[model samples]
Target: MTGIKMAAAVCVALFLIMPTIAIKNHDVTEELSDVPFISAADAAHMQEYVAFDTREKDAYQKEHVQDALSVPPAECSECLFDALDIYREMNILVYGADDAATADAVELLLKNGFERVWG
Candidate 1:
């Protein structure tokens, strides 16, 4: 599967991310550019969370997780509270073009009072 597709599957599985993930037959675990998605059996759990595509605006317009809001790195600033305070206690899922970026975005969200954030 493609890297992004594999990542999406991971997103779904995490919420029961699927099994072993590989991109174009390459095991990308060590070289992954994005956060590693985990596993959870309850898909319903996602209902209590919000998902954000933390890439640039153009990138997010081109592609993003279904139902996820587009919150570019710059947009993730303190202004988030204007709309996210009501959901501060909710779980969050942040994905970016790469792993490091995703981690940073997740951390930012957490610091801003998001209780839980998953890859």
Candidate 2:
């Protein structure tokens, strides 16, 4: 009976933990891709879409993509979800000083359900 109880407890624990593990894995997978660099011309053309510069506020204030919104990497997701009211269908372009930061922003956007998320 004790062995059976142990097995049942283990099963319950796994059942509770599985979803969290899956969610974490999904989050990791979402952020694993490199963000593509968009050219100035292309960016110009897509001006209707929101362009986010995922850099520090100082760096963003210095200079960034023309007309791009300054959303620091740490606050990108919150800015998008809260301040911007960006719908999943909206074309959202995320960029940074380098690929890794851009990719991180993209992952966050994608995870948050932005369908047209691009970097």
Candidate 3:
């Protein structure tokens, strides 16, 4: 009777709260996924570093961080290591049109053993 009703109520409350918790967790993950890389400000502060803008040469030449270099993403697979050799022991920050593209370039740089890689 009364005890059975109380138990049912508790179960219903738990079920309702569970969905809210799950939704909040999902929202947090979505927000984090959208920001998969570091900020430009962090890249700017590095003492010894290279900023590689993976955008097209035209877009890169139009406007880029001071001292940044233009290295299109398509060409990165072949040239990143060679370029890094010129700045050995310096941090490398890769950036592009958006986070996804930047993240892809960062992954390639890391795989190729470019230490201190960032994006």
Q: Judging by TM-score against the true structure, name the best candidate.
A: 1
Estimate, for each residue in 12-75, the C-alpha lDDT of model 2 and write its tens digit.
Answer: 4323322222212333344443443343334334424656767899987876555567878677
TM per model? 0.62, 0.59, 0.62
For each candidate, what is the lDDT? Answer: 0.58, 0.56, 0.56
lDDT of 1 at 79: 66
RMSD of 1: 7.7
1 versus 2: better TM-score goes to: 1
Q: Residues 56-83, candidate 1, lDDT per residue (tens digit)?
A: 9997787666667887878765666667
TM-score of 2: 0.59
Clashing pairs in 2: none
lDDT of 1: 0.58
Summarize candidate 3's per-residue lDDT along 9-105 as a digit string, tens digits.
3334323322222212344344335333544333334455566778888877776655567778777655566856776567776666755566677
Query: Candidate 3: TM-score?
Result: 0.62
Model 2, runs deviating above 4 Å: 1-47, 77-80
Q: Which stretches in model 3 have alpha-carbon errors above 4 Å? A: 1-36, 77-80
After best superposition, candidate 2 residue 104: deviation in angstroms? 0.5
Q: In model 2, how many backbone clashes occur?
A: 0
